[model samples]
Target chain A: MKARVHVMLKTGVLDPQGEAVRHALGAMGFDKVEGVRQGKVIDLELAEGTTEAEVAEMCEKLLANTVIERYEIDLD
Target chain B: MKARVHVMLKTGVLDPQGEAVRHALGAMGFDKVEGVRQGKVIDLELAEGTTEAEVAEMCEKLLANTVIERYEIDLD
Candidate 1:
């Protein structure tokens, strides 16, 4: 089974990396680019019997920093 | 318009960060986790008239490294 997780910064959290990307785009002459928020995607290949709950636990325990980030998971 | 771009390392490319994460998961006892791949997602808020081609151009120009990375663009 495969699971895809998207982890993004929570609203109001400071994202220096995102800001750096925005600045880089600006320097590259992408002047119309208004805002840029960067996040992460993790693709996990798990054993067949692994449950969604276990995958969520993985996000809570290590994949995501809940204090500053939120994650969404999709299983296939 | 909102565009979501997912950038991932091409297969056969070495991903030190993903390996680090896999190791970390193993250390935390996620023994059933087989493989992990890490990627980036960029959320872009563009002017209403921005075209998908333009956004893809952004990825090719600066958002993703085409040599080792491939990006998928979704506009909404």
Candidate 2:
């Protein structure tokens, strides 16, 4: 089985790294870029029979900081 | 318009960060995790009508290191 997690900062939280990228894009002449948000994607190859619940548990336990970030898990 | 870019290390490239994550997961008791790969997802809010070609150019020039990473652009 395979699982993928997408971890992103909460809407109201400040993202300095994303801000920097937006600023840099503007400076580089990509003026049409209005906003940027950066996130992480983790792909995991799991033992067959690993359940979606287990993947979600992994995200909650280690992959995501639930206080400031939200994570979505996709299983395959 | 909106665009998303997923940047990942090439298959042959060594991903130390991913390896570290896998090790941590094992220590944390996720023994079923066989492999892990970490990547970045950048979401961009663009001016209406921003073309996919422009997004691809951005990925090539700034978002991804072409020598070691590959990027996929999705426009929405």
* Candidate 1 residue spans exceeding 4 A from truth: none
- Worst 10-residue lDDT window for candidate 2 chain A reads A1-10
Residue-by-residue lDDT tens digits, candidate 2, A1-76: 8888999999999999889999999999999999999999999999999999889889999999999999988888
Q: Write the per-residue lDDT of candidate 1 for residues B1-76, one digit (tens) a residue.
A: 7889999999999988888888898899988788999999999878788889888888999999999999999999
Clash list (residue pairs), candidate 1: none
- 10 residues in a row with least lDDT, candidate 1 chain A: A25-34
Cα lDDT of all candidates, in order?
A: 0.91, 0.93
DockQ of each: 0.80, 0.89
DockQ of 2: 0.89
Cα displacement (Å) at residue A13, model 2: 0.4
